[model samples]
Target: MPDTALPPTIPTAPVTPAILESLRAIVGDKGLIADDQGKQPFVTDWRGSIVGNAAVVVRPANVEEVSKVVKLCHDNGIAIVPQAGNTGLMGGATPWPSHTGIVLSVGRMNKVLNVDPVGYSMTVEAGCVLQTLQETAASHDRFFPLFLGAQGSCMIGGNLSTNAGGVQVLRYGNARNLVMGLEVVLPNGDIWNGLRALKKDNTGYDLKHLFMGAEGTLGIITKAVLKLWPAAKDVATAWLAIRDPQAAIEILSEAHGASEDNVGSCELMSRTCTDMVLRNIPGTQDPLKADTEWFLLLEWTSARPKAEGAEGMAEKMEQFLADQMEAGRVIDAVIAQSEAQARNMWVIRESVAPASRAEGPGLSYDISVSISKVPEFIERGLKAALDILPSIRPYPLGHIGDGNIHFSFMGPKGMDRETLKQYSPAITRAVNDLVTSLDGSISAEHGIGIDKLDELSHYRSRIELDTMRTIKRALDPKNIMNPGKVLRI
Candidate 1:
């Protein structure tokens, strides 16, 4: 839990009638939602774990409107929380329960401004849904490889803001690598037009990176220029049953070696995660026949189309799996015979989240370590967690290819919600301690929202935390941009 207490009220930013009217004039009546019922959706997080309170919810339609809203709040000394999609796992987008500021939602500004197939880049509004961007790129015979379970609802702005990493990160990289430029609205309501779609720009101090994972503490990102890739014309997906985490890592290396680093995604899942998905999620069945302690969902993609009298990528992947099976590293494997089969195989991987939720309330930790230390960390961390509470069922799973793991655990069956909630803090501490000792991040892909402020402060050094505070203070001197987030300052 967060150590800091919520402020009773924001004394600086009083939500008076005149101030409300001023804000309404900028975004209009429909855009400014003042009723509690109308603001309900924006106040709460997607998981319902964090609930916030806001004086009003403001929807800005364009960059100019966003600037005006920010400027109005800035002049009045009011704090502003910029939100997009509201799909963040960490409480980054949620306002404090006692906060009396406005929630600036960018959902209305979603649009694809331009697509340059020749240049292999696309300019889009920050509020554009990630799935929509993927579809737009597909229409042009190009690919936007930033994909995740929440892509259907998550916005590009939030993706870039969190520097989101998905399964394709092994091949395409995270959101930071995919984005080329950004157009942000500063805290003082000034618009910085830095949206340059160039691959190489040797300029002084790349300012765009400051806000990429800042969680809106520095500025509000309103638009972005994203890099695209050639569409994958041939794809091969497989589900392999592995003996253990060590074997999974070995197979990942073997897959990369066999494919010349063409492997797109190599997802590792624990047996418990697979069982939960199979039981809770409908239409999900185990891809492999024999039971294994660990599983690896592998995929290989290539832009080259299949040609006559030539070996395809799928054939090579099958041959590689056969070789691994012969070596006894793979207990069993199933290669998707068709695209439909491939999608079905992916469904099991994607259903891990919802299925785990349906199983029971659990303590979830998103951490990362060096790729080589993954197996060791998992071994030690799981033992540490079980030692703390033997009844706890650890369900650790995630993008192990890049060392990011969603190490989560649920209480024993039939445990009440209140009892389960009591173990959260202790469980979190044990896992995080192991992660820090391994030189790993407490929050890997997830940004430090209000949820992990104390944890970050504890794990990071004085100089590191001070440098972050210095940057935050310099960019947002007033401290009105997403106040009480990232840094407690």
Candidate 2:
């Protein structure tokens, strides 16, 4: 396990024999994982970097069971680490190494409660897999626009907790925006059921927002009412070899009108990032074999069906690409002729994280700036890192339209993981400093988990940090809900 800084003071009280019996009585043996081997995966972060420990791994069958288990822990002052699909890159779902409390796994509460096709909304349990919800929405002739690499296993609760930003965020907004209401289990085990599917609710404090992106620090998200959109009947997916980051943004800027405001996603990919994925992830093919430094995976979707011989999404995209090529922004572009072709393009984009893991030790920063500053950030960011480690291989990609970049790098070739760690501190400092100077966020979509604990404290101002701590204390005075996460308090 990689060395990580833990909270200065967290509840380290062990689950004694009596408390264990009480827990078993509440959840039954089927829900409790008492053995260390059974609890290992729950405590370990997805990247396998931070390994924590829990006295027991508890899987509640439903909200009542969850409330009972939490109340038991709360009454005794035992720490509770609420976890969902456990697919977060940040260590938010993982318990701290010193934790002796319970790892509350909500995977068993997977359920789609209601689907309102006319209302364009769905009520679901937090433990429902994101892909499952998307499929459910599709079956109802609707669309859930949270598309990410880990949708297959990541849960809705964790997604909301992280306020996840996926490929389609440019069009649909983040997880919190999609959420109309939430049912959270508070730190003290009190249930807050704000599961109304209303588009307009100005009832005082809008309490649901607090739990959405709190990273399970304020409370545990138990259920949610998610907004949906009409299923796309006409779609266009294309791969364009763009001139550069500037050109990529300009193309997207013009595309908003050219596609008639139907642009669903605009993802920027560096040549190095694409090459890494092609090398590491098998069965992936390059979409456009053009000689260019950058690429854009652009998709446009419309709810209206394509009429015969009419100007549909494909026709419109074709014209846009032609205009872009003439304008010197697009060098070469190909609109997918079939579903299989589009799937292949998306596979290459989504497989980047896994491909990097397969490659070896590396550093990744999920930072963001204004849309226009993306090119400048990339240019200067690359220079800053290369100055520190000239051999470090750069693999940069992002949801360019949204200004969120996953600035990443592979360690110097042939360097061991231990040796790579030595350069991490200097490189991290340089990159973060540059981001701060540019008025950009040091951490973007990925919340400040155990990995960025100190970084958050370092970057955030005294007032901002104090405001966050005040809220944290107000919600979770005992500091038992996912302790040592998001904030030092």
Candidate 3:
């Protein structure tokens, strides 16, 4: 696909009793996963995107345990694949085939170590569920602002590894920006205790960042210190039927400027996306019945305000919408009157993935470009893809505020999935070209797992590619940590 040389196959060592015994001793019964029948669930990823064959899937209880297991693996020259939540879209956490390596799942180590509300930070083990962390933060009157559709199942370690961007990324930035520090187990089993919650640490090169989005190749994240914001005391959500993509952008910018930058999320969806969700997902109704071509789901949070005048904020939002209508930017819109209504409106946006699934046999691609160029990218890319596979149905939607669009193409009528996959790469390449031509990234929120492993080498320049390789070699000289991933070592 990228004209990059495929990696020469590495010889796998026979899993001698000594190897299993060593791993078992480090983590005891709870960590080591040797029996395939029992390790079935952990072997594959959430979407069943990629499956790895780890002879054993180990679960360490703490940093000490992780270091111990990693040390043993390093000594044995056994490759290790780190997994968390298994909800990655790019098959990042997918176990390698042939059971050659060990899959180190951090699910068991899910514990909220501490929440220092005074300092506005929380330290959580890598295994902590994302949704649990969000709830725990709320209990302490603080906010852990990482939001994803998979929050209920995905782990924080995976979030950082992928540098996940969610609906709230427009406000809090991606997962990488929200993290303060991390506890990493190095490639050679050395423990780097970097779990510092300091906001300003000018000590040296920010090493935590390397492992944060490294997809477990550079190191294994054991625990982390994540930054928190003031819990949102009030929030408002609205469904706007916009005239066009440019109008959607204008409404968001205007609302953002008027609301004192309190806007949390601003997403745009075509009627096609809405139609798919309504068709597949049950208990869904269109918020607006107008023949609107596009829609925007906007959210705002006034966290610091000490009064219960959110409706006033809502009124401000109404005026913002009126401004859009006056300019003919929006045709119709509705504001949610209650939290239940807010959740209902959110359901429409979240239902996209499930709806796409129900539609069946599609290629999913999430790529990003500049905010101003998103509409262009979508329009041009969609046209190009449909030209290539004229029968394909395009489902282009996502966080337009940040220029990241989850562009999916459903298989055409009577077309089998095998046929759809044949053109998947063509679709990806066409969109990638458009994105790069516009000076944007091929990946936005999701990490380049095995799904985009080859694409990374193609999209990135030779100098950038070599630099990343050098860093990887410097950190993981043996390439035993998540081998055959992310780069062409």
Candidate 4:
């Protein structure tokens, strides 16, 4: 949880009756959501923890409407919160309590403009759902590697804005890496069209990257040209009971050579997290019932189709697991023999967030350190957090291959929300301090939305913060583009 308090420095100019009429003219009544009841879902975050207020919810049907609407807000000095699917864990899309402007939602612009299988790329609107894009890629015999738990509801715009990373990051990369170009709506209502599909352009500074991870503080991403790849024909998914985090790392380290450079994902899960999912999320079964605290979900993929007589991913994975067991790193493991079995294994991993929500009040940190330092950081971090609240239960898991951990904890057995919050400050400081000492990041996959606003200022250097503020000021002079986000300017 983060401090939901808004700073007094942000623009709070209310959208008067005159401006409302102008907005309606630009997007029409169908695009405008003014009533409080219809605006609740847009104002609140996905967690339902951070409820905010907005003058209206504006859903633009196209980039032209988006441009005109932003121009109106700019003329009136009204703050705007550009939203996509509103599925971000961080409160980036949600407006503040003092927000008196509008939420510019691009959900109405969902469209796949083009798909070029030979070029290995696709042009899409920002509002396109992640799973929809993945399926679109599959239809053309290509693959979109960005896969996340929120893919069903999360939009491509938010994913790229936050530079989201998921299971496939180990093989492909982050959301930013997937994008080749972008079309943005500037704060002053001018459109900066950089939506090119070229593989390389040495013309000048690559401006597309400036907004991809800016979390909408810079501008709104309306369209993107995303890079695609050959669809996987041979893939393997496995569940393993590992000795510990260190063992998990060792297994992954050797897996690169053993899998012939086809490691897709390597996720580490604690028994507490797995059991929590099983208890809350239905139809999710335990893949392997081993007497261990830590488990690893390993996957391997290849573009080449498997021949009838040739050994496939399963055979190779079997031999590798056998070698790991002989080395005493792997306690026990199970390879998914069918697609249904693979899906079951993945359900256990992806259902963690919702399951945690159902369990109760908790804290989760998306932090990352060097691949080699993950074990040490986890060890010290657990001790530091436990020292403050000995009764708190820890649920630690991560993309171990990328050194990013969702270090989390549920409140003490019967402790209430307020009670848990009392110790949050101390516990948060202890965990974050340890991460800093190890030269790790406090916010990894999750961006510096309102949740990490203060944390970013506290952890980042003065020079770095100053440089970021300079960029924010240059791009959004009126401070109306997601004000009080990413930077204080």
lDDT head-to-head 1 vs 2, winner: 2
Q: In candidate 4, what are the lDDT values of residues 1-489, reduced to their tens digit?
A: 365335637798999999999999999999999999999999999888888889999999999999999988888899999999998887988888888889999999999999999999999999999999999999999999999999999999999999999888888888999999899999999999998998999899999999988999999999999999999999999999999999999999999999999999999999999999999999998899999999999999999999999999889999999999999999999999899999999998998899999999998899999999999998999998999999999999999989999999999999998888889888888888989998999988989788888888889999999999899989888999999787777
Instruction: Report the lDDT tens digits of candidate 3 across residue range 418-481.
Output: 6777887777788788888999988888888777888888889999999999999898887788
How good is model 1 by TM-score? 0.97
Poorest 10 consecutive residues by lDDT, candidate 1: 2-11
lDDT of 1: 0.87
For candidate 3, the 10 contiguous residues with the lowest summed lDDT are: 1-10
List, residue by residue over 1-489, the lDDT tens digit for candidate 2.
333354557888889999999999998999999898999899998889888889999999999989988888888999999999999987999987788899999999899999999999999998999999999999999999999899999999999999999999899998889999999899888898899999999879999888878899998899999999999999999999999999999999999999999999999999989998999888999999999989999999999999998999999999999999999999999999999999999999999999999999999999999999999999999999999999999989999989999999999899988998888888888999999999999888988878888888889999999999999999888888899888887
lDDT of 2: 0.92
Minimal lDDT window, size 10, model 2: 1-10
lDDT of 2 at 341: 97
- Clashing residue pairs in candidate 1, if any? none
Off by over 4 Å in 4: 4-8
* TM-scores vs. true structure, each candidate: 0.97, 0.99, 0.96, 0.99
Q: Give one digit per residue, the lDDT tens place, for model 1 in 1-489.
A: 243434423325777899989888888988888888999999898777788889989998999999999998888888888899988888899998767788999999999999999999999998999999999999999999998888889999989989999898888888899988999999999999989999999989888898899899889999999999999988889999988888888888888989877899999888888888899989877788777789889999899997887788888998998999888889988889988889878888887777877887777899999888899999999998888779989888889889999898777888876787777677788888999889899988978888887778888899999999898778777788998887778
List clash counts for every candidate, in order. 0, 0, 4, 0
Displacement of the residue 14 alpha carbon in candidate 3, Å: 3.5
Give residue 279's lDDT in candidate 4 (0 to 100): 99
Task: Using TM-score, rank the candidates from best to worst.
Answer: 4, 2, 1, 3
